[model samples]
Target chain A: MDDETRALIDALVADARESPADLARQTGLSAEEVEARLADLEESGVLRGYSAVVDWDRTDETGVEAVLEVNVELDRETAYDDVARRIAESPLVDTMRLVSGDYDFEVYVRAGSMGAVSRFVSEEVAPLPAVTSTVTHFAMETYKERGVLFDDGDDDDRLSVTP
Target chain B: MSDETGSEAADRSDGTAPPDPADSVEGSDQSDPAEASDPTGEGETTAGDRFTAADRVARVPPSGIRAFFEVAEAHDDVVSLGVGEPDFSAPWPARSAAVASLERGRTSYTANRGTAELRRAIAGRVERYGHAYDPDEEVLVTTGASEAVDLAFRAFVDPGDTVALPTPTYVSYEPGVTFAGGDPLAVPTYHEDDWALTPEALAEAGADEAEMLVLCYPNNPTGATMSADELDAVAAFCVDNDLLVVSDEIYAALTYDGDHESVATRPGMRERTVVINGFSKAYAMTGLRLGYALAPPGAIEAMTTVHQYGMLSAPTTAQHAAVAAIERCDDEVARMRREYDRRRRYLTARLRELGLAVAEPSGAFYAFPRVTDVAPDGDDEAFATDLLDEVGVAAVPGSAFGSGGAGHLRLSYATGMGELKEATRRLERYLDGR
Candidate 1:
């Protein structure tokens, strides 16, 4: 690869969230070169993660961010796709992740306000057939923002990739 | 974590609280924890892609200005200082000229290069800045400065061309470049230098093979102006590199310090610069949708031909009105500029009082103040949004203009002095609330 392609990959690693064309231009690389390197990196597990850079002010102002930990009551006949689709349609839910441990699913929601969060749970999530119970946790502060860490920071606090 | 067995997932068992659907998907996965279960049961086939559906309909999230407007939309009782649209009507002479054109039944399309009279007026106007153009060949009237901006990019840039921009500049520049299939290379201008784009930064951005240089002054978000000496240096650089300059001087007449400098005036520059200006800011005619571009004859021909195929012509009556605006609205322009100057002074003082790091804006109707002085870790987009939610006043985030906009908010003084004062009062209350 050329120097420009290397610089492009370095920038992409710095943020880990840039579009291929954007990374290419910033690093003075051709878009094709950037795309090829990105594909190689993805195949090798060098670029393993991508996440949103939340504008906390806009998010907090428009809605409240809540991590809803849900414990599902297991059943054979229950329609899981129908339930997931219902949650996905609601404007309040920003991201929904399936996690390990006691909770079956971790859902991140952003409501218009604290009141809106309660209303959304009561009106939308409550009506779903297969759901059992949920526990909500509000984020207090983001101590270290995503895509802003490098070698100087501790590996534990920073995001790392396994090759 | 409760280890609930299957068959307990039929309905809401916990009667006290509402059961969220997210739990049901989780419950199904847990029923067979060892075997991977697809929530959709199609094993990876969804009815429609969740990601694609969400991405297709995604909205440009509510900025501080938009959020405030939404609130004002619901509550008419709320005295809104929201949205930076100028409160003044198009000056009387321009309005009457438009009315006269309607009476005379001048509603049909004019030439794609615009009504000859208006094109002549634009040429005459540019001549004052020492940038002369051939009205018949080098000027093409667009729907507005917005269209001219897009046309300039479309005319000069091919796919993958890099267009250098100075930040905190116009919000529309980057998007316009993108629409024309060009990448925006935003060169950050420091607040300490009054947001001037220096020769060094310009040279660095231009070092690569690029098709266009997008310049706006007196700038939008920062309200910064480049002096004649600065303009000369930029013009020389463009000439040396054989790069086209897309100059957006919509706020040219609104300069407070002195006459606005046009880079097109420099030697061997007019042939390479497309000068974009409009009747919007100068005559308080934002709704009129009238603007024109003066480029080298060949580029103007291409742009005018594009207009012929795409737009046909600008509004007929607005073109007539624009002719009158250029001919007779000198006094009205001066008056509005004076009012804006007063508001600029008042806002600069208020920003300083609020402990914002700000320099006096020399041109345009905006004051870009650094909000980090009060909230060190404050995000421009976040702080501005929260400020609107808490207080009624609205301002755009600095980053909307370009990369150098972090930790800053752009306050437009285009409203009345009383409204500007009220906005400052609301900002103070918002600071205290935080």
Candidate 2:
């Protein structure tokens, strides 16, 4: 049962929208097995969620994306989790991680504009009680997002036919 | 694809690096054998000319894949299941290491046997396959697995010695043997046996006369894989006959069901086997052209002798990248293998539903479907040509891979599942119209 669950998760990791039939074939489990296993995963929250990988720049509304490194001076009660929870309340935070080395937390900020991003960092984030120092490294380009290359440089370079 | 045949890169695709006559792809009907057999009209010779291709060079026939390439080249929207390489890119670390090698100015030639690090890596990689080779003496890295095959036959086989090649395998093996001055004895391995060479079949094919046996499995064109028990039988036969074995395990890591057993691991087989493997199929580094030969010291020395005098060494950047591939990219290899396995299952099931007899492929990316149901009288070539013209989908005729492969179409599952689904739809439509 756990084997099927792992296979399902692996297949889902490759293509979130993969049909149950393809998932079944890929994982070597029956369609019913896939359905049951997926339901189990969702029920247990082992499968977190499925979402689309979007490049906001390509869409109508352009956004500035940046990595905000927050080094917080935490008290005995204000743990890393508390800091993450407070910072994550802002909608600008796309992803938050309590990363080690050089920073206490790494927050990915994606906003409609550079001014919005700066405003969110200054007004909402920097003023936090535990926040000691913060560094903003704005991304000029998003070359890859969620493992998908933004460009077609990985085109097939092989000859039309080879043995 | 048809537009740029003059480049040096295109020539490397050919087994012997023959000049591509694909510029004629504009008008010539490649379906005609007479025209295709002499693609460049180089067969027309003049007595006064100073340069004539030697009998060894002229004797090797044009690969059956050439016509299919030309047919595919003529079309714009071809969803080809005819490719033999992996669709995945090289693992990120390997790609980055290649870039780093250039950035670090390691652009000069490597050792004739390859760099110490890469040779050690090759030794370690082959060690996982259950054979231990001395990195300094037993591993000889070549331009690609294709080159290692040529060097193996050339190093061991004499002018008239025969090399037994199983039918319906990689197209390069036969020509490669011939080019090395060895007569290739075609031992037909039937689809009934999953395209594997059995002891009885070997004896019937008079393999006892051959000095060496050539193998590729999980195979190309057929995707047949043999169990360790089956390999033990063949390995015993090789021992009894005292024949050398050149086993190409390029598709070894891509085996879908069960483990891929190397013939070298069999008793009495290690000393006689020259193990050829590469990053092309498994690591998706075909463009890098990195492969290695693991053999006994004597065989490696001979192959290196031929390699140094002719090809010298493999690309330095490629060697460094290969080390990184061996050390850091196993997860990437597994991911690619899983993807191919998924596509393989999808293609095989869909083709079977379409009323074609598909031997469930247990290895490699190909699904060899017998086309006698649609292609009456087993004329796969004509059937394939019609399939291309009737629909825009392209596939290689099984006859292209040699005997025991006739009456079938070798459809590759190397592309994306979406593309396979679309190709299968077109195939279903073609079948329905039939």
Candidate 3:
């Protein structure tokens, strides 16, 4: 396997309660190398702890995801982080990044409905000094779901089984 | 594949000046036509060993497409529209004339500017289309329009000069431009405009820092031709902006509908425009490797200088054949042109009937239709690749041309009518699944 695939194996063993062999079987890696690599990673504090990958989609929280492309006010003297924090403090804001070109930032904000999103934009998002014009695009139906990339037989088999 | 070793540059680069076209060995022998077809082996070397092994050699990892062609070639029952060349033999008169030249042993090198007789013939031919040229000073015979294009780039463009070209163009233009150390500026020609190069777009292209602008009429891939007014506008734009125009009119004589006009024929445009023409299309002599360019005297001299250093001249015997062919404008060329025109008409109608948005092809032997017009999100390359893979048809993907060709497919109707019908049938079946 390539270098990226090796690192992925070590990360899997440290984070989730999966054995090196299981990870190997899941990612098409050699079981022996996976075990040895994981041992070395743990000794270096690289393998930290096991955590669960919770099904956020099935959770009680009903949040709608939308993309917000922000064009910064050219006259404003405020820095990027100033606007970032204002949006980040709201629990609805999931991700934000400073970007190039016509837009200064891309904000991924999760709220309830269109009305609720409008409310957040007007009250919480618009009032900020560093704020600029925002264009919103709603999420359409997903044709392919994104998840952990696994190609080995075991991962395919495990995915086939429903909880 | 052969053990014959020349200068590393000769093997790796195509920029070196070639040998004299008048070399006897480069001519056709009536006894062996294949011998005449050999590309001249002299002046084939370069001075510097600059590139690494990887840079010099092309790695031929298995090509599924080539493999398919190999398999297809073995079958006698297989009717193929896969190949993109005329199925007819070189017109008998042209062949006979070529044989006569070989028999006469007029196999010596001609002037770098080409023979007086052949140049006069080319001049006469161009004059018929309203483009006046001095055969002695303006024209230089080369090895097909392909070589003329390569020479155009090398002679006119400096290291950073951008050569603007409309996309959905011939595949060779980009590589040739790059080989000349120039950048290829691809302007997207969409199906919405029926693939016409708009005046606004042409103006912008000329306004760009590009030193050269290329236009192919009876265009390849799209089979679209610019109208007389369009040609005039383009010529005016190029003249205004001082961009050298390279008009490839190889398929000029094959226009199906009406008269074929050259941009060089426009008022005051001949000086700036390089008219590239060849026998490959009209005479159905693809294997002959013969073509010519009519440029301004200075451009002709520059191209000859480059040709001398890199490629000395076009094949000698082919030049003689060309002289004979041009001298006698027989019914053979006219007959072939009529046949191609018939094929062009039939193919476009059939494609439109199939529900593909085929732009009415006024010229050339190609029919480029938008694939997504029938199948949405239909990747043209995948569609073409899969078609060849499953059903065994070998049309090129329009994407191979440029970005403007994203959802299009280029089908050549140069083959026999029977093969064309079979290809259309297969296409119909393929689209039926969609």
Give, for candidate 1 chain A, the lowest lDDT window spanning 10 residues. A154-163
Least well predicted 10-residue stretch by lDDT in candidate 2 chain B: B1-10
- DockQ of all predictions against the true structure, Cα-based: 0.01, 0.37, 0.00
Off by over 4 Å in 2: A1-7, A62-66, A113-119, A133-139, A152-154, B1-50
The parts of candidate 1 lying over 4 Å away from their true place are A1-163, B1-82, B206-208, B432-434
lDDT of 2: 0.79
> Could you tell me which 10 consecutive residues in candidate 1 chain B have the lowest summed lDDT?
B1-10
Please give, for residues B78-100, the per-residue lDDT of candidate 1 as tens digits: 33333334556789999999999
TM-score chain B for all models: 0.83, 0.91, 0.83
RMSD of 1: 28.9
- Tens-place lDDT per residue, model 1, A8-79, is 555554456655644554444556877887788779986776666665663435556788876666477665
List TM-scores for all candidates, in order: 0.61, 0.89, 0.62
Give the per-residue lDDT digits (tens) of candidate 3, residues A67-144.
788766644566777777677788877678888887888887777887778888878777666666878876653333
lDDT (Cα, 0-100) at B216 in candidate 1: 83
Taking the tens digit of each residue's C-alpha lDDT, what string does model 2 give over A29-137? Answer: 7889889888988999888899888877778877788999999987889988998999998888989998879888899998888899889989988899999989999
- Against the true structure, candidate 3 reaches a TM-score of 0.62
Report RMSD (Å) for each prediction in the order shown: 28.9, 4.2, 27.7
